[model samples]
Target chain A: MKLDEFHLERIQSQWENIVDYNLSESGVEPLRLNELVPHNRLQREILETKLGYPQTNGSIPLRRNVSSLYEGATEDHVLVTNGGSEANMVSIWNMLHESDDRDEVVVELPNYMQIWGYSRAFGANVKSFWLTEGDGAWLPDIEGLKDMVSKKTNLIALCNPNNPTGATMKEEHLKAIAEIAEDCGAWILSDEIYRGAELVEQRTPTMWDYYDRVLVTSGLSKAYGLPGLRIGWIACKDEDKVRDLWSYSDYTSIAPSMLGDRLGQMALEPAMREFIEKRTKRILKENWAAMEKWLGENEDIMTCIPPEAAPVCLVKYSESIKSTELAESLIQEKSVLVAPGDHFLLPQTIRIGYGHDKKKLVKGLSLTADFLRGEE
Target chain B: MKLDEFHLERIQSQWENIVDYNLSESGVEPLRLNELVPHNRLQREILETKLGYPQTNGSIPLRRNVSSLYEGATEDHVLVTNGGSEANMVSIWNMLHESDDRDEVVVELPNYMQIWGYSRAFGANVKSFWLTEGDGAWLPDIEGLKDMVSKKTNLIALCNPNNPTGATMKEEHLKAIAEIAEDCGAWILSDEIYRGAELVEQRTPTMWDYYDRVLVTSGLSKAYGLPGLRIGWIACKDEDKVRDLWSYSDYTSIAPSMLGDRLGQMALEPAMREFIEKRTKRILKENWAAMEKWLGENEDIMTCIPPEAAPVCLVKYSESIKSTELAESLIQEKSVLVAPGDHFLLPQTIRIGYGHDKKKLVKGLSLTADFLRGEE
Candidate 1:
């Protein structure tokens, strides 16, 4: 029952709202309800929705829409959850529960730590392989993962279009990782919540395409700009696997909110899905300019790998201060908030989220620069 | 990492939509979004809400409204969760996490099995005390609970306006239970989700009034008829205990949905809260009449203790068939679904939900009666 504190979430939960310029958000400015349901017919349908439990797994249409994102998947392959957080939580729990002998978890590091924290919480022997910085790209250590996993590994977790660094794994690399997991006979849980919010034209590859024993967890929170809906899902090739995950979710939050399911279904309709993704790309493009300018201005004190996807990039600082202390100082002195690298198990770095409010992003960046200069 | 199947929820999830008549639902007909936000001001506010993560712990106004339900409490004393289900899940997890030595959970049985299942799932030694049927009331076995608890009992969980039986423990009895928990210095978790849906005029007593070491879990899903909103909260006297519970929720579902937080605040505005409760009372009153008539007409084959609260009642059937078999038959032959008493650890009975449409209720009841008599 003992859980090490999830420092990233705990710090954000405490400071995100109170900070004057919060640069800690990792998704684009969220969609307002009217924008999400632009047509009167859809709005009316939403209003008419009985605030009842939607299908506990997910409504058929919602699941169907979610399934459409993955080739050859059907409604049976999906289980809708409250958020991507739960999607990862349930999938991990299910994988851990499915096999009694395999109690070890291998994780991709410099990633979102939800899986890492939860794996440890569930009493797994959590081992990690890092995403190392080299030549302006954060690269996954496939060979390291090959060495780290074993017959005892029940699950291997990955965050594609990875958190903090926003570095993505190529299809070939994902295949190699999948093969590593397969060698150990472990299920792969790929957290692809950042799939569509790519900086480049090529869509990031999914672990689902490479492995039979894969559970892909994604939601509207990151790429789709609908975090408030709290609609996330776990998709697998095997219908029974998804069904088993749904049973685990039954013990968590029973169902997604009614509006989340209905509106989320609308958001995932082919055209609307394209529109939301395009909007995310557009916003990320616009905001990244301000971030680029700030990084350019503070090149003497800060450097970043330039995120390939997602709305965030981790900047390694030139100063010797601890990442937590640096982040705390930013909050106390400049009223700006950014995720400290310490929470991601990397020190002397900070993750800047540039997905929300261009002006605030600029102001937050400028204030952060001021703080960095003062430290110097 | 293994969990017992949550039969009640599993069965309901599978058949609630498939059945022609679903009497397995425990709450009244859910409120549509339009009904929940009838006023234009509220509607506009909802439409304008940016679908982003609200405060992860819940928005200030929502927590304030939740705290308002308990005397001498503040927003600091409350943590908004996905549903009353998560409220209980987090509270139990927190209590178990807080103390390592205490691993046993004493539960009130013939109850909603969520806490029971989750307690065992979390690796706690789960013990139970029963609710005995006597003189048309389901009475708590307080003495039996005292016998069940010890220094090792970490928590005691209760359902007020109890599930299945619609039983409400008197305030004096609740105090006695609290004193028994106090003896072992254990936390008490009272699921008050069904508190407001009483058939009688008097409100059900709350554990918050009696015990300092108590977590009262309630939400809009049940008594308020807003299951779709999925807004639930935990209220405790100690500010720090609520804070600790919020940390566990960080690993579950980070926050309630954005619309849930916003609209839930409006729903809990004093006037709106009163209106919703009155509407629930009205629906229960109108529907229970038809239920009463059906009970009277079928007295020869079926008997019920006449529930004092909630929209559900457990009907004891004369047939010797297993409760699961009878429920399966009801679903297959009658196209009606009722919760099997076996799911609640009591056989030869079925829990009927009569809070929805009265016509459907009547039809479902008549079909149930036909099914019961045919077994003769």
Candidate 2:
């Protein structure tokens, strides 16, 4: 029952109240009420029909819809979970048989807490390869990753368009990782929650496309802007892995919520898919532009590796102001909340999200800039 | 991952067809959905509003409403899950930390597959205490239970108004088991999904009332006739256990579905509570009466241990045919589906659920009796 300190939830519980601006979040700009489907009528009808036990795997229609997102995947390959978090947890728990003495897990550092947290929970030996800010961009060192591989390693977890850092691995880099994983005979789990938010024209290629050993995890919470709906899925090419994870998934969530699945299905429709792409393109373009202008205007106070895909970017403060202390001061002084980089093992950096309303993002950044300049 | 064969889903792929009854299930007769809640304009208004991420633990209103069902338990004690299945699984996995050297779990035979399935999945050394037909009433033998308990035992799971058998334990018997659990330092988890479906009483005494080491899990699926809602809860008296499980629960389900929570709250209202009680009482009383009449008329062909609560009973066929074969024949010949007791480790006993419409239950029993009597 004694959990490792690193596995504990590190996000301070107090600042949950900051409203209007939440730059700490990794998900894309969330859906407004009007954007959700059934639209109004469908939601009403579903609610009128008393919510009952949904299908154990997921509603068939929802599963079919999710399966359609991939080229050859079917409902059998898809397992709907509570959210991407559960999807990732179940996949890891099932793939990395925890009780086996030989089981070890490799996770990318400067990543979200979920991968390591669950890894530690299962009593696995988890090693992290640091993704440092080098050559003006954040990326994992190929040698560092190679050094972590071993015969005992059961899985390698990567978050593409990595959270906090917002750095993405190119297709060649992912294929290289896949080759290494195949050599080690380990499952490669790619958390693509932020997959659809690429700022550039080339979307990150899914690991599944390269290796049968890969499992792709994504959900509506991130790129689709529907975190509230709380629907996520895992697509695995291996039938045995699919069945193993499905069993674990049943224990976690007898099935995904029917309402969540329905809404998620609607969100994956051609129209919704195009809407999400457009939204991601619009938000990333505008917000990154705003960030560049803001940083340029106050060059002496802060610096960051510009985000290429996801909504978040990690910025280093000019002086030793302790990221946590500075984040708290920002929230208290200007009601602008950002995640401290210490939570992700990068103490000098702070994670700032750029996926809010244009006007609000501008106002918040200006206030943050003024505060950093000690003018507030 | 080399999972033990014990953890494998007991029913083969063919058994999945039995779940298809949901399409034709009559909510009025078996589940009594109508009396449970009356959808009004105000509730409809709430449904139309976009449901965001519900409280990760559960919605506050919904948790509070669920807490009101228990005497000493509060909202803090309740952890809402996807359904009774998740609640049971969370309790089992968190409580039973099976490692290489020490692992033991004792579960009731003739119980729901989920309880034992999850136990085995955790790689625990699982032992089953029988609820045999020879016992006449399907009660666990205290001496037999004591013989199975050991210092290494970490957990024991049971189903009240036991699934398939539908046997309800008296308060004193439950307390005795709790004492045994206390001596071994084992956590006792009771699945009480059919809590309000007692044939004669307004309410049944729960194991939670007898022991702090006990965790009581239930959901709105069965008695409330709202399985589609997929809302269930785990209430533990131990605060530390609650906290630990809450953390693990987070990895399982970030939160219950907001729509499920909202509808669950409405279903737990004072009016709805009374309505469900009345409906369940009527259905259980009438169904059992019809079943008793059928048993009396065909005493030479079959025998049953009359169920005290819930809507199911284990009926032993005098014919030499295995329960699985009989169940398959019934489904194929009559389009009447009933769960095979083989899933519960009872080979000759067929589980007959009286939760359907009175006429259907009567007709199904008649058909089953005719088939057993070689008159088909």
Candidate 3:
């Protein structure tokens, strides 16, 4: 009935018209239309074919592709949604509805805004586990996380290869979090949107592998670079929980776009799988190199905890400038767009995405460097 | 988290395999798609060129076209949604959210299931205003509705040119109901899915003309014969309510399908509008005649209150046969699917849809006649 201002959406709205050079984007250098698979001929054929209503859960082919991404997961365990946003919302709502005493949610701060936004929307008390800059890395305080968990905690939401900070949790840390969740009968909702884009790994071990209560939400948007298609899925081992989420899903979005489902399936094909993996590696390698070079040239004004996986890396600004002011100045003077750290609850940092057009990345970072040096 | 069985989804759900006849269904009395459009290249171009995200509320071009159907309406007053289903859901949720005390919803019984389903999903107390056989026509009793209205009633939902009964509310009666809604400070949600398929007249005046609180939900699915496109819109006179619904719309569905929006715009174009009007008149005229003739031949076994609009009419079965049993028998023996009236809260009746191909209708009716005559 009554809704508070959607904090993240409001921020997005503010930047909607300020398009100059988007240096602040959080995803991998987004794939151009030509970068997508099946070639133009195949895409044309798909567009020409009459697209009927997609299966509300997901197209079987797409679900099968997503299922293969998990070790023991089946098509039955996956529910394709509008996007990762809907996937997260449905999973959280289901978890909250399942336990009345579980009215609180624990999320890692300096994470994606939706993790906290959705938790708050469900009327849950959200406690954020801070990720701090120490020992040359942005690492989560596992002890803080332990303290945040309680008998009333229904969900523990985490973003692996985390947004903005790009902080990733190792298998040991995930297992530790899973143990706490299991003990308290809480579900661990690990947002793996940046899963496949990891710089060094073939794949990250999801929380779902460690605990049946864990729910993994991911989509083709980030790793596969198909945000325009708007296809996402939730993988859960609990059949009852899956069913409950499906029912709630019906009330939210009856079904995902049929065209998107088809494209997602194509993008997940065995051959396409290899293509995306190679593509992600290439993009990450180039972008990270560009970022390292730029940061080296501007060491006096900026420093970053190198990202382990995702294309995004958080760079702390000099004490002379606020992150927002620096970001605004960079945009206005250099026509470069980079996200301010405040969006991720870290005010002293700015998020720079290396994944973009190689030329644009080079040009934008140069402009950013020049702007910082008063050479613009 | 523990969820109730009713809330949990069962694996391999039933809804997916329901044999949606709307897809690829055609017969001798075929609903020819070409008859409605005469092969317009512009429509095809629009569908093909339609890409990228649609406006969150709706595509301005499509919304403008939809607004033209209403007197003094503008694009700002329309909120495009996934379908009539989503439109109805948004309006109901918004209305219930606006006032806490008015948490109950009154809906016309023997109407579409979605009307009540959405109300119940929103935690609204749902009470039905029944349509009984005491009336020569299937009409809502004004007195019954008056008695049903209470201080707690926040919304009232109805379908004009009703789903199962093909009952159309008179303009005077609609005005009276609108007056009651205004007096009680409740919102009126009119499902006008079959708006243009009137048997004789052009169409009834929409409730929107008389009340600022009325929300008219319609789609291209039924009368426009574009169900495959999956496009719908809600028109509200109040700008504040429109804004509120649009804000809620973002969280529910980020946007309607872009391709669907483009197709909807083309479908409402001047030429397409003329085609739809002509095709609707022809189909209803022929279908009504066929139904009348079938009823004339089987007067003793079954009878119907001749419908004024919509493609469906309820025929009362003889007291000897249960409506559900008769419907099941028809489906099993003849492969002619007709909904059991009990699904619409009419136990002694079965809904017969004459919107299918003429030969299918003839065969179906003949099969019914033979069954009644003890031939099958």
Native contacts matched by each model: 0.81, 0.36, 0.12
Tens digits of per-residue lDDT, candidate 3, A147-193, equal 88988988888898688777788888788888888887777898998
Tens digit of per-residue lDDT, candidate 2, span A241-337: 6666776665565666656766777778788789877887788888889888988887787888888788888888786888878777888888887
Model 2 residue A3 CA deviation (Å) reads 2.6
Best candidate, DockQ-wise?
1
Report the CAPRI category for model 3.
acceptable
Q: Which ten residues in a row have the lowest lDDT in candidate 3 chain A?
A: A8-17
> Which tens-of-lDDT digit does each residue in B293-376 have in candidate 3?
989988988889987777788888785777667666665565555666766777877777786566667777787778767786
Tens digit per residue, CA lDDT, model 2, B216-292: 99988777767766788898877667767767666665667666777678789888778776877787787788989
Interface RMSD of 3: 5.0
State how far residue B121 of model 3 sits from its true place (Å).
Answer: 3.6
lDDT of residue B48 for candidate 3:
47
TM-score, ranked from best to worst = 1, 2, 3
Per-candidate TM-scores read 0.99, 0.88, 0.83
Going through the candidates in order, their DockQ values are 0.77, 0.34, 0.24
lDDT of 2 at B118: 65
DockQ of 2: 0.34
User: How large is the interface RMSD of candidate 2?
Assistant: 4.3
